[model samples]
Target: MSSGPTGQPSLVRTGAKAGLAFAGSAIKGGLLGLILGGGVFFFYLGQLKGPGNTAARAGGAGAILALVTSPPLLVAVLLLLFVVVYAMLGVQRGRTKAMQHLVAARGEAVSERLAGAIAGRIEAMPRTHGTLQRAADWLSVDALSKQLAPVLGEGKAVRSVVGFVLNRLPMSDMLAEWQEGRAAHGAPVAAEGAAQDPALRALLTRRINETLQEMSTPSRKPLYIALGAHAVLLGVGLWLVN
Candidate 1:
């Protein structure tokens, strides 16, 4: 939504576009799933129930029906499987694309928030490209954990995030740089030098750990559908055998 001069929020077309994309994908996905699943069923049925014996003149039509049905079943199963696999792949790809958007949005959010927090405390921290890159490499785990937290839950996310943050958040480097050069030339010896500021580092470490402990969780829709499909297939196969 965008704010107008009158202060009322206006609906943007982004939501409409997203909705249409989702709907189209959903229809395509459904068709694919049905075809693939139905094909599997047809093939399995054909294989289990082979063409029955039919003598000339009396049951010729019956025998012909079985043969015709069996091959068609196989074809149906093939079609179904093809559709299902493709649909699933499409959905997964779509999800990844959507996530990229979210990642970009959230990344900006995190950066802006962090900048605000450090605005007054730090001075002339001249944005060196590789500095943050190196910091990110060092902070990979924490960064990943934080990124995953919203989707994966807070408890687990926090612990994972904190662990990485602790290992990556080198207070010594920050403190040493601060105490030695421009920022803190004669401010205070920075408790522990660049090579060893364990205390402040520990605080960040603790937070990551705590966050990991409170991690968020993933959805269970796929799991449930998978279990149901397996159960249905197993039951049907067993019934046919019996």
Candidate 2:
């Protein structure tokens, strides 16, 4: 919502737009349900009624519709829909929250491992153009683990930090340069620190708020596919009941 004199009007307009959008979405969902329900009944009712019972086919059709659209069945379908939607949408949120927990619980260890793995590699790269990807690779491989094992030791903890660096948060390259008080662009360090003042921890925590904001959100295709699968399963159950 915007502020100032036009705020009230803008808010009203926004609310109206949201209402319309929701209504349109509901209509589409209803239409899709009707179409799927009709298709399922058409395919199954014929086999259920049999050929000699053609006279009662129409009646059986009605009975099937009534059964499938009953309050209990409808409620089940709606609940399943909600579950599928939530599962699809909540995956990213859950993954991010878990990552947050990992960082909080093991920040120091992970940062030290990360710095051990990639810091020397980045610093030894002759300040090339592809310093970033190389830094990521160094963190990814295990061969470099030996380089810093004497100090930081080696363990499964490195995997956790590497995944975060390459996938969730991207600060691998900066840690090395920060330690040396320089950057790939040949810029000298300005202030030379963060709150904790350790290079690895600084790089890990620095811009973390902003980097997390850039985490990729799951797309809608999987959501649609999940909903379709749920609808099919519900159809199968209804068929069994009939």
The prediction achieving the highest lDDT against the true structure is 2
- Kindly list the per-residue Cα lDDT of model 1 for residues 180-205, writing each as its tens digit: 55344444433211333333334334
User: Lowest summed lDDT over 10 consecutive residues: which window, candidate 2?
Assistant: 189-198
Score candidate 1 by TM-score against the native. Answer: 0.31
Per-residue alpha-carbon lDDT of candidate 2 for residues 76-165, written as tens digits (9 for 90 to 100): 445345543544344444444444444443444445545544544544454545455555554554554455344333444334345445
Provide the overall lDDT of each model, using Cα atoms, as 2-decimal numbers: 0.41, 0.46
Which residue runs does candidate 1 get wrong by more than 4 Å? 1-11, 50-93, 100-242
Model 1 alpha-carbon miss at residue 136, Å? 17
Q: Against the true structure, candidate 2 has what lDDT? A: 0.46
